[model samples]
Target chain A: MKIREVTLSTTPNAEAVADLRLGDIIYLDGLIYTAREGVYMRALEQKANIPMELPSQSAANFHCSPAAVIREDGSFDLGAVTATASFRFAKWLPEWMAKTGARLIIGKGGMSSKDYNEYFVPNGAVYLSTVGYGTGALLGRGVETVEAVHWHEELGIAQAMWVIRARRMGPFIVASNLQGECLFERENAKISENLDRVYEGTKPAVLKRYGETDDRSDEVIG
Target chain B: MISLDLIQTTAETLMDKAAIEIPQDYLDGLRAAAATEDGDLSSFVLQAMLENYEAAKEDRRAMCGDTGVPRWFVKMGNDARVEGGFVALEAALRRATANATTGVPLRPNRVHPLWRTDHNNNVGIGAPEIEYGFEPEGEWMDLITVHKGGLFGTDYRMLFPSDGIEGIKRFYLDSLVAFGKRGLACQPAIIGIGLGGSKDTCMVLGKRASVLRTVGSRNSDPKIAAMEDEFKELGNSIGMGAMGFVGKNMVIDCNIEVGYCHTGGMQMSVHAFCLSSRRAVARIFPDGRVEHRTDPNWFTDYQRRETIEWDPAREAAE
Candidate 1:
């Protein structure tokens, strides 16, 4: 399908997401949150029930803003900013999902199949990753500072939330999703096959020197 | 002698906010893409560019590497003359260039090709690569200097001549496939390409063209943009999928640069970099005036190529 960019200028959040596919590049502009990984993990350690008003659904997006997504007009209503990373909360996500109704996790990649299966469907959350090291490109999208970052003073850069304006925030693929349809598997199948081929063809001399006979050949060719 | 403070502070400020003035067309193509594009990676990549802007503002760091190698595009007025010395004025400008290197910790970029030794990354040896043009009629001289970033080191790759392929897109797709086959995507990187020059220069121009782009800039020519559009479509159609996972699309954006080429015998090549295509560009004015075009109309909405001929069923019915 055409890469989708829907302007989710809904009630509590005015965010946009790319109608994501297996592959597409996205740049987000407009408001988002920054969930420092260290601070969030600490929250989990304390068994803290940090609160929010607009807790997300499996379909909603997680943004990197300093402020919680709030009523467009500003009231008690708020939205759950996606955690910075999903696996960063591997231990915490299952419990967090049961309570919060948060669906989206946006950051860099890497999540296990088990994580994708459990909390994702039960809690209706999807894990998304932002572009890696494209900080400069992301900055060009512009930032709207809504809330000054707030956290326990000692928390330092961790745990503080600053609502921001994200530009082109998505079109991010959930390499792993509640549904078995994973972006990671489809993308890497060809690669894995090719690697197996190379390994199987490894030279006998090279394998002897490295003490690395091909395991792939024994499994497949045999 | 030019005062020490003047040299230090002026070049410092100029280096920062240097890429800000790039035409919106460039940024509009790649950066502004945030506003459009449906693919997840496309939006995310666009977001990363947006962050570049934010960091520049918060830290007040140059948007992308001191607006790249600072050199003035000068048009001197007939009446304009130095009061004390021409060489001294140029020398003072040179000194300011010296201070910029330390202040920015800019990569030691420039080196002689023949001698192959390091030059202080100075605007020396015509290093800033100055070009002078006097208006045939006008009195006022216009000087614009751009600081091009030096994103050199190991990221260089070459595009093969088309081998009778249709256009640049095939070359780009081939590069992405090769990179995937090599496991380069395990790290974050973008493929940068330059086409139409000689084997070496064409590749160099590709990398350099990326610098011309603001953190998220795109090619200006409509034809090039169309090719980019086609590139994305072909990529997605092939099912490489995001992260090579689901769809045919593997690349976030296949940025390509081209010089004029023959209609019958177009030369195309590839340069793929793993995830971090760290790039930046800048400009400087001889009179200390500078600006960059921040946006441009670069890529168009993803368009499936229009079917040229009527379908067999439709033809039969007609």
Candidate 2:
């Protein structure tokens, strides 16, 4: 698999993301903004404001709710911040991407694999699936700082928008890429084919045990 | 009578432990999975999970940000006495969960679904749900806590009699495949299958199987054990890998729990728990002896112990 490094900035280099492919590995560094289902929906309705000045199709956004605590000393104690499923906001993602100018979407499970071509490819965006349970590792070494930007009270500590600085924050799989390829769909189809082959191989034996002839048309005849 | 303070403290400690410590069975299962991974991505992902466990434990942090809903399975003794009674016990648990929001520092997961209102402390009406089981003879109360991701990667379904065994198999495979396509999003899940009960009972059993049962433990009934074995192998064969990359093992294990149905229809449910199966059990005796148990054993007759050494350096070398 190909590997690429991404750095989120106000003027993100679009060329750096143009050659991204499905199943490639990405190590994201630099600045990132956090958002979840609420932020996207609220932003689309024009009710909420995105605090960061993100460049179109060059910014990396994490779909997460963080367990962050502000200490009495004024420093932030970052807790486990996990990915909310991408497809949960399926209908709004295309618009969110277009409006927010987010180029890289980091989440778990790929965004509705069925519509990757429609939602991601045209926008020069990609969906990367992070290691689901690696929250501790990410919070420990990846993230350097986190500051609440907007919706801190309404969205709680986790689902709120936060500006963060990260260092090698990810080694995510490119579930969907700019080339319109989707790793999640490809992998599922392969597994389904193998499962079908197993079912077919076991059908005759199961039928024989029930004292039924393996004529292959019992259900069809019925 | 058990003091209310004891109950509150126990609940707080248990939630904190559950959030920080990745259960031994979970770590063991992941180590075994890493050892057998056929693809580089799977191995890398599995190893990262192990490292996440160490990092959480060392840093005193929540293992997964989605510390999940606070679910308590309370086994109460028939003759046990409490200072505040059941009402007080429930209240204490609720307070304990909200308090742990900072101690275990659980993510504030409780929210008003429609308006997106934050409750801040994970406490709400019918929140921190307690499933009580009364034992006729016992002097101690056992509280088993499971922090399950309530929103993401949860599934339930009902089947008509016509659906039959073939239908059950199809449902199991179809869900796993769908979840797999989503990538280890919930990949390498410990699947809990509940067959032949009302929808609610089936969901309860499914949750118990996934969160309580030890990773490699089996159902005592021969049929269910065989079914578990078959599905475990079949799930791994799908090769959804560690994080849904192409690999040998999609599931760490499968646990199937069953109950007699009404003979009219079957309510089969599957609870998918991500590799981070976070849970902790605490037992409080009448004599004031408090013991913490890592093995949940919600269905099995006896508790079994499996010591797992999640050595990141060793795994990295492998």
Candidate 3:
């Protein structure tokens, strides 16, 4: 519930982020790297070195594709920046968290509980989910500079590795914390239970509303 | 005759408007949802989203980082004459897309899938995809462009005739549960359900429902409209909240579009659009009068929802 401001480097320990609880908003200040499917897949395949020295503690890799216009002077206009979903990167989360020392992986759409329990919880990391539509808010964090360290040509500006200096950059929720607790999963569990009960309670009303009474077995619902 | 230059100019205007402005209907829907939302945090999140939208307008920047793939729905006049014909119309849109990548300052999202080549511009093979609906007698073109951002999760299923209505509802609920987690798929989601069609038709219909249709619209068939109402109530009961938290509202609306399928089997596609729900539409008359609209009115016959309260004990007794 409280806003916690934390500074992260590319070499801090994951224990720095372990105590952050789910749903707590945090403002991240430091060097945060950006990557997506291509860079991460290529890194795993070639065993190539990642682009930045990320903080081991609050080491965050945002699944973002920034709408940045690089000026002739090599400065970025820093237009829109939003999180890409993490579902596609499901299988690689464990390796990504371990290898990159990314104790905090920020993106939308929660990751699988398996990945959370196996990798994030045990590794002292958390998966934070921010609003994917909050491009202006994300850009409001004050991006000082952008340096593309790797994979620019392959993935273009959107999917390449860009080391960015962000000041008070994030207002993201701890979607899944280090203790294997996930806010999304917990909420979904409640919803799922509610769904069953609601379905049972509402089926007759629904059928009647659609004019598909039990006696009229041949009538299609829609 | 509509000149190629006009087409090009109109396309440019459409792209910019679509990128820069969140439609009035969508804004109104968000405000209503926020006001009605019972969850404290979720309501705050909705308000914050509204603020984010205003910020986007003030900054003249994209509302979201992902501009998404552009989905164009064009309804052309039957007797309309064009200087360069249909091909020219498509080319103009493509050029507009390319220019808008930097002009609207859209993030270059279209890429060569196989070679992993970034186009720099959003135009590429099958990029900025367009769908056409022609009128028998008219002199204007109604163009509606919707952004298919990343937050809308994709779904498709093949069902035997046996699957029926219960099966369809089950598939929909399951998909919602899977994609609507952690605000990942983005909630107060607007779902588009396409049923009883070929695979592609179902998919397109689903996408149309998700993006093209207005939030408060419904199907003409009373049965289908009733189904929409039920899904909306059931989806809200799940309590996915604003950003996948525990709350009262999950989906603000559900639009179902159905097509007749062969006797053997049926294909269904479910597409979910996030709360942003970005779209803009422009219509050009014969005399060269261009009217831009926030609502495309994709659903021709929109039936309003009846006011009703949830009754648990009545259902429990039944």
> How many clashing residue pairs appear in each of the predictions shown?
125, 5, 8
TM-score of 2: 0.86
Deviation from native of the Cα of residue B90 in model 1, angstroms: 24
Q: What TM-score does each of the candidates earn? A: 0.41, 0.86, 0.84
lDDT (Cα atoms) of all candidates against the true structure: 0.41, 0.71, 0.70
- Whole-model lDDT, model 2: 0.71
* DockQ-based CAPRI category assigned to the predicted complex of candidate 2: acceptable
Q: Give the TM-score of candidate 1.
A: 0.41
Tell me what TM-score chain A of model 3 achieves: 0.77
lDDT of 3 at B39: 67
- Whose DockQ is higher: candidate 2's or candidate 3's? 2
Off by over 4 Å in 3: A1-16, A49-51, A56-58, A69-75, A90-99, A121-123, A132-141, A147-149, A201-222, B150-152, B160-164, B264-266, B299-318
lDDT tens digits by residue: candidate 3, A80-108: 67787777786676788777667778787
Report the C-alpha lDDT of model 2 over A164-213, residue by residue, as the tens digit. 77766665666776667767666655555566554543312121124534
- Every model: iRMSD: 13.0, 5.6, 6.1
Maximum-TM-score candidate: 2
The window of 10 residues in a row where model 2 chain A has the poorest summed lDDT is: A213-222
Among these predictions, the greatest lDDT belongs to 2
